[model samples]
Target: MALFDRYLAGQLLVYFGFFSLVLVAVYWVNRAISLFDSLIAGGSSVITFLEFTALALPNVIYAVLPVSALVATLYGINRLSSDSEMVVAQTTGLSPWRLARPVLAFGLVVALMVSVLGHVLVPLSRTALAERGAELSRDVTARFLKEGEFLHPGRGVTVYVREITPQGELLGLFLQDRRNAAMRTSYTAERAILVRVDGTTRLVMFDGMAQTLQVEDRSLVTTTFQDFAYDLAGLAGGDDGARRRDPREMPTPALLRADAETQAVTRKDVAKLRSEGNVRFSEALFALGLPLLALGFLMLGGYSRFGLWRQILGAVVAAILLKMLANVTETAARDDAALWWTVYIPAILTLALGFALVWRDTRGPHLIRPRGDGAPA
Candidate 1:
C-alpha cells in the first residue's frame, strides 16, 4: 500500500510539473503579445518587461493549478486503467477510496501552495509592479517631446520645436505661457535644451525673442536676448514623482489594517475601499478552494471508465462553472453581507457530490440501484 501510494504521488507530481510549465509558457506568450503595445507606450525596457511578467507568475499559477490538477488526475487514472493496472489493484482488494487517497493528498498540497501565493506573494508583486509602471510612465512621458509638435506638459504652457535631434536638443524653439490672467508671455529661441535642476525642469533658450502681452491695454511689447531661461516649476506637478497606491496593490495585512482604521468611515469613500478589500480577500480564498475542487473532480473521474478525454471535458466544465459561481457570489458578497452565504456553498456541494459518488461506487451496483430490474427496491 505504501509503495502504491508513492507511485501514484510520483505520477501526479511528474504530470503536474509538465503541465504547469506548458501552461505558464502559453500564458506568458499570450500576455507578452497583449502587453507589447502598452509596454512600448509606457517606455518600458526589456528588463522592465521581464520584471513585470515575472511578477505576474504568482497570479497565473493560482489560476492554472486547479485545471492542471484535474487534467493530470484524469490522465493518470486513465493510464492506470488502460494498462490494466487499476483492474489488477481492484482484484487485489484495493478499494476506489484507497486508490484516490494519494490524488487527494496531491490536491491538498497544491491548495496550500496556491493559498500562500495568493494571500502573500501576489499582493506584494502587485504593489511593486504598480510602482514600477508609474515610474516607467513618467520616463516615457518625459522622453516623448517631439519637434514640430506642440507639447503641453501641464497647465497653460505650450512648447513647440521646429527641429530636434535624437538627443533632444532643440532648434527654433517656441514657448507660450498663458497662466496669468493679467499677462501672457511668448518666447522664441534659435536653440534650447531642456535641463533639470533641483528636481525641476527648465528650458534654457539661447539668443531668443521674448514678448509680453499686457491684458490691461491689449498691448504687446517684444524684446530679444543673448541668453534666457524659462522657469518650468509649473510645467509639471512636484508630486508626479509620487507613486499611486491602489488597494489591490496593498498586501493582505496592510489591507486589513486599512479596513480596521476606516471602519467608522461610512462615507462613499470608505465603502469603496471596503469593497475593494473584500474583493481581494475573496479572490485569495477562492484560489485556495480551487485545489479542493480539483480533488473532488478527480474522485468523479475515477468512476467514469469511458476515457481520459471525457473526464477532462467534465472536469473543465466543472471548473468553469465553479469559477462562474464564485464570481457571481463574490459580486453579491461585495454588495450585501448576507450574500456571503454563497461563497462556500459550491465548495460544499463539490465535496458532498464527490464523496457520494465514491461511496456509491464502492458499494457496487446492487447497493447503488435495484439488483436486476432497474426499479428501486
Candidate 2:
C-alpha cells in the first residue's frame, strides 16, 4: 500500500510540475508583454522591468495552482487506468477510497502552497510592486532624458533634449510649461542636471534663458541666467512617498483585524476586508477539493479497456461549474460579509460528492446468493 501510494503520488507531482510550469510560462508571457510596453514607454530601465515581473509571479502562481492540481489528478489517473496499473491495484483489494488517499494527499500539498502564496507572498509582492511603480512614475530624470524626442510628461508640459551625456548631463534642453493657462513659460538651456531639494525634483539648468508670456495682458518678459531652477516635482503628481495600499495588498491578519480607522486609511470597508480574508481560505480549500472531485468522477465506473473519456469530460465540466459557483459566492460575499459562509460551498459540496462516490463504490451492488441453483430467489 505504501508503495502503491508512492507510485501514484509521484506521478501526480510530476504531472503537476509540468502543467504548472507550462501554464505559468503562458501567463507570464502574456503579462510580460503588457508590462514591457508600459515600462519601456515610460523610459524605465531593464532592471526595473525584471523587478516588476518578478514581483508579479506570486499572484500568477496562486491563480494557476488549483487548475494545475485538477489537471494533474486527471492526467495521472487516466494514464494509470489506461495502462492497467490501476486495475491491477484494484484486483489486490484496493478500494476506490484507498486508491484516492494519495490523490487527496497531493491536493493537500497543493493547498498549502496556495495558502502561503495567497496569504503572505502575494500581499508582500503586491505592496512592493505598487511602491516601486509609484517611485518609477515620479522619476523625472528618466522621463526627461530621452535624446532628440519631444516628451510629454503631463498635459501642457513638453520636454525635449538634444543629447544625453555618459556623465548624466542633459544638453540642449528645452521645456515648455503652459499648465497655468493664464501664463506661458519656456526655458532653453545649454546644459541641465536633475537635483533633489526637500524631497522634490528640480531641473537645474545652466546658461538658460526663460521667456514668460502673460495671457491677459499680452505682455512678454524674458530673463537670461547662468543657473535656474525649475520644479519637476509637479510632473509626478508631487507625491514623494508610496501611495496607500489596496485592500488586496493588506496582510490577512491586518485586514481581518482592521478597525474603522484602518478602513478609512485603506479605503476598504469591513465587508471588503472580510471578503478578502474569506477568499484566501476558500481558495485553498478549493484547491484541496479539486483532486477529490476529479478522482471521484473518474472512479464512477470500473476501468474500461478503451478509455474513461466520458468520466474525464464529466469531471472537467463539474470542476468548471464548481469554480463558477465559487466565484459567484465570492462576489456575493464581497457585497455582504454576512454571506461569507457561502464561499465554502464549492469545497463542501465537492468533498461531499467525492465521499458519496466512495461510499457507493465501497458498497458495490449487493448480490443475492443463488438459491437451489435456480434462477428464482
Candidate 3:
C-alpha cells in the first residue's frame, strides 16, 4: 500500500511538471514577443530584453501552477481508470479514505510550492525588475544618442545630433522646444553631455545659443551661453520608479505590516496593502484544493469504454466557477481589510465539496466488500 501511494504520487508529480513546461513555453512565446517589442521600442538592447523577460517569469509560473495541478490530477485519474489500475486497487479493499491520503499529500506539496513563489521569488523578481526599469529610464545616452536623425522625445521637443563620439560626447546638437504655446525656443550647441542629478536626467549643452520667440507679441529674444542645463525628467521614457512604490512589488511581510511607513512608501491605503498581503496566503489554499476537487469529481463515476468525459468537463466547470468565486471574494476583501477571511471561502468550500464527492462515490453497492467481515461498514 505504501508502494501504491508512491506510484500515484510520483505519476501525478511527473505529469504536473510536463504540463507546466508545455504551458509555460506557450505563455513565454506570447509574452516574449510583446516584451521584445516594448523593450526594443524603448531603445533597450537584446540582453536587456532577455533579462526583463526572465525577471517576469516568476509571475507567469506562479499563475500556471494551479492550472497545471488540475490538469495533472484529471489526467492521472483518467489514466489509472483506463488502464484498470483503479479497479485493481479498489478490488483490493482500499477504502476511499485510504486513497485520498496520497492525493491530499500531493496537493499539500503543490500548495507549498505555491506558497514559496508567492512569498519569496515573486517579490524578489518584481523588485529587481522595478530597479532595472528605473536605471533604464535614467539612461539618456542609450535612449537618445542616435546620431544623424531627428528625434522627438515629447510632443513639443525635437532633438538632433550630428555625431556621438566614443567618449560619450554629442557634437552639433540641435534642440527645439515649443511646448509653450506662446513661445518657441531653439538651441544649437557645439557639444552636449548627459548628466544625472538626484534620479533625474539632464542634458547640458556647451557653447550654445538659445532663440526664443513670443508668439502672441511677435517678439524675439536671444541668449548665448557657455553651458546650459535642460531638464528631461517628465519627458518621454521617464522613470516611473520615482513616482511611487507599488504595493504588489513590496514583500509580503511589508504589505502584511500595513503600517504607516508601508502605506506612505506605497502611497496606498491599509485596506489595499492588507488585502494584497492576505491574498498571497490564500493562494496556497487554492493550490491545495483544486487538485483534490478535480480528482474527486472524476472518481464519482465508474469505468466505461467512453471514458470520463462528462466528469472531466464537470471538473473543468467547477474549477472555473471556483476561480470566479475567488475573484468575487478578492474584490470584497480589497474594499475592506476587515473582510480578509473572505479570501479563504472558495478554497474551504472546494475542499468540503471535494470530500463529499469522493465519500459519496466510494459508498454503497458499487463499492466491493472489504476483507475482514466488515458488516457493510
The global C-alpha lDDT for each of the candidates, from Candidate 1 onward, is 0.65, 0.85, 0.85
Model 1 TM-score relative to the real fold: 0.69
Mind giving the per-residue lDDT tens digits that candidate 3 earns over 190-230? 99999888877899999999999999999999999999999
State the number of backbone clashes in model 2.
0
**What would the per-residue lDDT of candidate 1 be over residues 1-377, giving only the tens digit for each residue?**
97998898788878977888888789878987767656544334567678888888877776677667666766776677778877787789988678768766776776676667666777688877776654554342353366677765545767777987887778888888899989999999999888877866667889989999999999999999988877665554443444445655555555445455443332223334445555554544444344444444444433334544554566568767877876776566557654555666555555555566566566653432223465466
TM-score to true structure, per model: 0.69, 0.83, 0.83
Regarding TM-score, does 2 or 3 come out ahead? Answer: 3
Model 3 segments more than 4 A misplaced: 148-162, 172-191, 197-199, 205-228, 236-243, 364-377
Clashes of each: 0, 0, 0
> What's the residue-level lDDT of 243 in candidate 1?
46
